[model samples]
Target chain A: MNNWKIFSNGLFKENPVFVLLLGMCPTLGVTTSAINGLGMGLATTFVLLLSNVTISLVSNLIPDKIRIPGYIVIIATVVTILEICMAAYLPALHEALGIFIPLIVVNCIVLGRAEAFAAKNTPLSSLLDGLGMGLGFTLGLALLGSTREILGSGKLFNATLYDENYGILVFVLAPGAFIALGYLIAIINKIKKSL
Target chain B: MEKRLESNFKNMVLVLCAITLFSSLSVASINALTAEKLNEVRLQNQLKAIRDVLPAFDNNPMEESDTLITPDGGTLVLFPASREGERVGTAVKSYSNNGYSGPIWLMIGFTPDGAVYNYTVLEHKETPGLGSKMSTWFARGNKGDITGQIPGSKGLRARKDGGEIDAITAATVSSRAFLDAVNRASGALSGNADAVSGATGLEASPGATPVEQPDATTGATPVEEPDASSGATRVDDPSRTDTSLPDTTHLSPARHE
Candidate 1:
């Protein structure tokens, strides 16, 4: 496939959250606010891109029997670097993301892409794929976060749009995550059908 | 067929080991590079917490901090607030193991006379909306405000326990923990400066040998004296009477007024 097809594929056709439904844990957990969603999305994207490129580069050297563990170590290392960098320079965001930041090591999308695509593809293609998938994940999280934040708390990105007390409190809680993600998937499905 | 299987297993083990070594080395180096910066951020956060609870002081509180061991075996770091050569107040980094979820950490500031200047929850995992209200719920004008109250003059328990302070709505456990942390901090500061300093050095370390006690003339040894009114026995371990006092005499006598 051409570069455009490789990159755009994850953006829509194989979207990690809405289409493939990977990384549901963070999608549902940190999308309490638009900023938190975006922060989580960006951090995951950083990990995905680096892991994809590195896995593709080293795929040849890794034996088939040990490929899963090899990929995991690489992804975990990348996540650790990201975690330390955030804690040192972006302390506020680091605090806001809390435990979810470290949990990125277990994110399925990073490993899934490494096993399914990056291992088989060239480094360039893998890089494109990571960028595309990461962007798609970010978009999905941002959407879910905005919906929940606006409905559950009457605020967007922590900026109060109205009296926050007037919000539908449940949307900001755990159940609200499932409800929001469910409706968002339905909307995406409808749009894809029309397209 | 046996040779092929042996070679395959060997390759797998070699690849895993090589990858692990590389990963470990990289993580170690990055940790080294960022460790200092991480500590700086942590110190800044702590200083900010101390400043939030205590009045303004000229000296850097982080530099003036000393670790004291609570009776329950937890470490309490006391940040002494001072201006010029005089001490203003003290903000104690205290924790209580009695929270609903787990330990609740608080930075509680006390004037030299023992009245609470103010307090702020440094960290907590209490239930949101209910237990987490212990953050601001214990401040002045709030339902559980204990600001300006002396911890030793009366028990700082929730009213349910027959104390003057109100508990957080539906969060009596968290309220109790918060008050307990404040009480621990205040108890540390109630004695003369030298005695508390000596106690900090002696008690802060778990396995270290207890040092000699300071001169009795300082009158700070009264901290370990059993109080008949409080109905608590304070058995002083003879060995931990001193490790040299951490100059708490910098505190201005004016604060006692």
Candidate 2:
């Protein structure tokens, strides 16, 4: 496989969020604003990259039947490290992410990449896959966050675009998440079909 | 194809244990490295909260903070702000557990003469558009503004309860909880020792009134003695107090720091 293709596959062709439909919990929960979505995506990306690299390094040592448990232990440890470090250094972002930070331990995207790609690939390829997938996921979240924030709060990246009072409140709530995500997926599907 | 290592019990246990051990070591080291910085960040946030509610003071309010036992068994941390050796006022960290989302914490400021200076919501989980309005809803211009009002002369309950304060649009429960916290702080500052009597119905008054409400506002007096006096309640233990508390306070302008 071409190195570039392996790296860029996650951006569009094999996008984890829109295409693969991985990591839906954070996708709907924290993408209420552009900043939050981007923040969460980046945090997840960091975890994905680290876990992918580490899992690839140790894949040969683990038996197939116990692979899932091994992957989970590694991912949980990385997540705990990330959580503590963020709480200590990036207190603002840590608080902003709140419960979602710890929830990343169970984020299927991290574990999925570890099993599907990292377990079978070399360290360098696994790293690129993680990066590509992370970027794709981040972009999807940003798109959703911007859509929700714009319609629901009349703001972009915390900047006000219009009278916030006139915003459609539903876009920022639970139902709004489903509505926006459904429309976003529909649009992406149309784009892919035309391409 | 050569059969890879079997998923035998021994192999699985060994692999899992190895991963757990490595992860544990890595996490422990990272935690050790970041723990101090996290504490510093938390303290800075607290300092910022205290500064937001209280007026300017020449002395360092952080060092001057003292713990006071409220009439209702809650321990309040009072930060005294002073200028030129004269006591300006005090900010009290108070909590009301009656919030719709459980406990709501507030940092309330009181002038020397018993008027509200300002207040800031420290922590809360109230509904966003409704109860979360407590953040700035009680400012000087908001409909439920509590700034400059004397909770002593005018009662602290919402108008729904026959008091003068206004409630949030759709968050009466949160509004009541907020007022209860503010009133508790005000009661602590009234220096009547039996100040909790005024804050009844909102709090759980267990049994006998035990602790003397030490007037920390009389001068730069520390709350150590009153904290010791309230040792019987177990609620006022200095070690067990919610380390970061909020409320209004009695202003004593003495330079203890």
Best by DockQ: 2
Q: After superposing candidate 1 on the true structure, give the runs of residues whose Cα lies further than 4 Å from its correct spot.
A: B1-7, B128-146, B155-172, B191-257
- Model 1 over residues B1-257: C-alpha lDDT tens digits? 01111328778888889999999999999999999999999988898888898888889878777886543367788889998868889998988776776788999998877889998887887754457668788898987889888876343766866678888765666777777777767656664232234534344333221222234314454443322123221112221232111112211222210
Worst 10 residues of 2 chain B by lDDT: B239-248
**Top-TM-score candidate index:** 2
lDDT digits (tens) for residues A1-195 of candidate 1: 999999998989999989999999999999988888999999998998999999988888887777888899999999999999999999989987888988988999989999999988989999999999999999999999999989977889878998866888678778889999999999999999999
Please tell me how candidate 1 rates in CAPRI terms. Answer: acceptable
DockQ of each: 0.29, 0.52
Q: What is candidate 2's local distance difference test score? A: 0.77
Q: TM-score of the candidate numbered 2? A: 0.82
- Model 2, residue B4: C-alpha shift (Å): 4.7
Give one digit per residue, the lDDT tens place, for model 2 in A4-93. Answer: 999899999988878898899999999888998999999999999999999898898889998998899899998999999888888888
Per-chain TM-score (chain B), model 2: 0.73
Q: Candidate 1: lDDT of A195?
A: 91
